[model samples]
Target: MRAVVYDTYSQDLSSLEVREVPKPKVGPGTVLVKVKAAGVNPVDWKVMAGYLDPLMDAYFPVIPGWDVAGVVEAVGFDTPEFHVGDEVMAYARKDVVQGGTFAEYVVVPAKAVALKPAELSWEQAGGLPLAGGTAQRALDTLGDLDGKTLLVHGAAGGVGSLAVQLGVARGATVLGTASEKNFDFLRGLGAVPVAYGEGVVERVLEAAGGKVDAVADFVGEQLETTLAVLADGGKHVSIADGGVAEHGGRYVWVRPDGGETARLGELAASGALKVEVAQSFGLDQVAQAFALSQSGHVRGKLVIVP
Candidate 1:
């Protein structure tokens, strides 16, 4: 099988090579999937460049991706939940960064896989796992938002867009920060849009009528701003910044939860959630895909057809 492999961490794209590698053997309680598509995320490049070296282990010749959508080709021993030909999606991050979903085939724990929603295209399904799981984790960290007001920074991006829709579904009034170009996009997701540059606090205050009961920061470096606008005793969480914990807020690192992934699939199937694919590239063009993800300005998800 062919995959995108990196033998060492390098900022330059030269380290990534598309080449043949031995197929992964299925393990107990896991399923082997015939790869259809994979989602490109900023973390893929960041990890490749050694940003996460102190935190996670990277097995050399690593394949870089966590989000995948594909058809089940075989089930490992005792994995009775799925069989050959079941369409599925998963957040397939393992503790070690190897055997990722950037190839002709990949293996994932059955528990980490969710049946793909029939309503979603393969690209959307592949893009759904990581961002959707992050959004759901943010909402979970905040507890009940019913009848409250919430603010999301960078709400037009992959995770933020899903956060807006999920927040609104929980009966909270969601106000999202983005550029003027994405205000309409945020509004379309049921959020009141506030421009994120100068005077952002005042703009958000105006949009929320002077109340921000909670906040989820998808964009980093906003701890001070979050402290300024958040209501006293209100809750907040940041996925990008660890400094949030010092300010009485939580720092979230999204983890794979089969139950939560399944819930997200159900939401998409019911038409209550949507995923936007900003652009897609063939598997061999993964370097180009990573460049686009690193730009940090894409309005939605980027996917790779493998």
Candidate 2:
């Protein structure tokens, strides 16, 4: 199997290489998936560059990716949940950095796998797990959004877009922060768009008619505005910034949860959620895909068709 691997941590995307590697063997309670598509996330590059070194362990020569949508080519012993030809998607992050989804195949625990929704394309399914689960986790931390006013920072990006739609689907009045160019995009997701930057608090206040009930910060550095516009006792969460914990808000780190991933798949299948693919790249373009994701300007997912 040909896979992308980086021998050492570095900021340069060129460190990633497509190399011929052994096809991963499945084990008990895990299944081997033939990769169809893999989603490129900022975390992929961040980890590759050693930004997460303190928090996680990394083995040399790591394959870089977590979000995958593929077909089950083989099931491991005692893995009765899926068979050899089932389509599946998973948040396939392991305990340590190695053997990721940016390859011809990945072996994921059966518990981390979900049957991909028939309504979603392979690209959409590949892009769904990580971002969708993150959005769901942040919302879950905020409690019930029904009839509440919710705000999302970075509402145009992958997780943020999903968060905006999920907030609306959960009956929240959603207000989102994005640049003017993406205002229409947010609005299409059923959110009231407020341009981010100077005076964002006032703009968010105006959009929400005052303080919002909860805020989910997808883009970091929104703590000041979040603190200013949150109603008394309002809930808040951030995925990008851990500093939120000091300010009465939680910093969320999404773990692989097949249950939550499947719930998101249901939402997409029911037409209550949409997964946007900003661009798709072939295996050799992994570096370019990583660069685009690192730009922080990608409106949707950057998928690698492997």
**Number of the top-ranking candidate, with lDDT as the measure:** 2
Q: For every model shown, what is its TM-score relative to the native structure?
A: 0.98, 0.99
Off by over 4 Å in 2: none
Worst 10 residues of 1 by lDDT: 252-261
Give the alpha-carbon lDDT of every model: 0.91, 0.93
Give the per-residue lDDT of model 1 (tens digit) for 1-306: 999999999999867899999999999989999989898888899889999999888889899999999999999989999999999999998888888989999999888999998999999999999999999999999999999999999999999999999999999999999988998898899999988877988888888888599999999998877988999899999999999999899998888767778899999999899998899888789999888778788998999898
Candidate 1 structure lDDT: 0.91
Worst ten in a row by lDDT for model 2: 291-300
Tens-digit lDDT track of model 2 for 172-266: 99999999999888888999999999999999898789999999999999999999999998999999999999999999999997888899999
- In Å, residue 61's CA in model 1 sits off its true spot by 0.5
